[model samples]
Target: MIEIFTVDAFATNPFKGNPACVCLSFMNDEHSDDFDQLFQKIAKEMNLSETAFITKSSTSTSTYFLQWFTPKNEVPLCGHATLSTAHILFDQHLSQSNELIFETKHVGQLKVRKLKENFLELDFPQGQPQPILLSETIVEELKQKLCIKSDIKGN
Candidate 1:
């Protein structure tokens, strides 16, 4: 039987944060396409926002490949999912290293460090947000959609 773990990522309490199911081992009879279908089916069955599949890394012996999927489609990156995967690895003695590297298809390699017994740090790519001007009509529409009646405060 395949082992599946449900982890609550970014939560101090259980079931408080984004929870994802992690699958460590999976075998496909036919090929890669079959694996994709199976993975999607498992995610759909789990019915979580994200499910992480961990596979052996084709390149590095120490690192592992991680793929995240939702009930609908595959996600390129997920911070909380990655952290949850790392937490499982360390807590369960899946890896010996204090820092574990996970390879991804779109986001490249991610680094996760076991800071302490219950603490972990993830090294993610830096993202910069750009501000855009919004028309009054669009702003008003957004406000109506969001049901914000109080005065808007600018940060």
Candidate 2:
């Protein structure tokens, strides 16, 4: 069975901050077509906002393959989940180095470094904003639902 950890990201105490479930795998397991489905099932079962799957890279000791999943679908990137994954690795003494690299499918490589006082730093790449046009009716509906009074601007 795979090892799982539930962590509170960006919190010094328990029951605070965002909670994320992290799944750790050590073996060089191949990702079959059913692997993502299995991960989705696990995420659904966990019932957390986000679940992270971390697999140790066979090529590099300090690098791992990371994937994030929500209860509904897979996500491209999640900051809290990434922090939780790094926390687990450091807490469990799974990594020998102070720096770790997480390879993702959509977001490329993310670097996490362990600092003094049990703090962890994540070097996340800046994402470019994509503009989307929205209909006035939909915007009005959203504004009404969100209780927005001022004008809502969209691309």
Candidate 3:
């Protein structure tokens, strides 16, 4: 049977932080397609933002393979779900190592370290946003909504 942990991470309150379904694999793993379907079904059942599945050796020597799924679809990387998975592992004493490595579709190598018993440190890359120039029509709409007039004219 697959071992699963439902964990709340990143916040003290149960409902405030993200809720994640963490599953650890053992012998005779589920098929890829079945597992994907399982994730989709469980995610839909939980109706959470994301759920994570992690698998590793008993010694934790092998890298942990992680997959994240949203209620609607699969996501490349989910920070909160990853943190929740790590938290569950750490709490269970399964992860004795100070640092936990996660390989994801988006984040190639994710490092999650334990700062304290309840605190975890996650290191990931930042997503940069591109600048968009607003058109005069959009600006006018904003002004009308906010009741503020701009002195600049349309180019």
Candidate 4:
């Protein structure tokens, strides 16, 4: 049996913040043959930004295979989902630890810390956008679209 919960982190009111579907572990459980299909089905059923499934690990305390699926696609790293997941685990699973570690795709070893005012803070990598120059044709198209003849920054 997969226990599911809808967590509202970063906001107390429903639909104000990002909603995530969180699935907890149960004994003698194994995902179906098409796990991705199942994930997508759950995500669509929940109609949220992301859905997370946690399978209990048999050998390790700090280890579990974590997967995240968005409504449109599967994302490697999602800051909001990570925060929601950690908040769920801390408040529901782990009572003694205020911080939770998550092993993710791009942002490996992700940490979510509990903050005052019932907010959770997530630490992840910073993505920097490099400046790029658009071609003359693209510039002309943008100028025609927005009716502005100015330099447009592209990344």
For lDDT, the strongest prediction is 2
Off by over 4 Å in 1: 27-34, 127-135, 138-155
Candidate 2 residue-wise lDDT, 28-146, digit = tens: 56434357888999999999999999765665877888889999999999999999998888777655568888888898999999986568899999999997899888898899999
Query: By TM-score, how accurate is candidate 1?
Result: 0.77
Give lDDT for model 2: 0.85
Misplaced by over 4 Å in model 2 are 26-33, 132-155
Ranking by TM-score: 2, 1, 3, 4
lDDT of 4 by residue, 25-134 (tens): 53124333356677767777777878886554443454444568877777777667777777777777675666666655455566677775467777787777897778
Residues 14-84, candidate 1, lDDT per residue (tens digit)? 86988989887651221143467788888999999999987776665447878889999899998888888
The per-model lDDT (C-alpha) reads: 0.80, 0.85, 0.72, 0.67
Could you tally the backbone clashes for each prediction? Answer: 0, 0, 0, 0
**Model 3 misplacement above 4 A:** 25-34, 57-62, 93-95, 131-155
Model 4 CA deviation exceeding 4 Å by range: 26-34, 57-63, 128-155
Q: What value does the lDDT take at residue 121 in candidate 3?
A: 94
Worst 10 residues of 2 by lDDT: 25-34
* Model 4, CA-based lDDT: 0.67
What's the CA RMSD of model 2 in angstroms? 3.6
TM-score against truth, every candidate: 0.77, 0.80, 0.72, 0.69
TM-score top scorer: 2
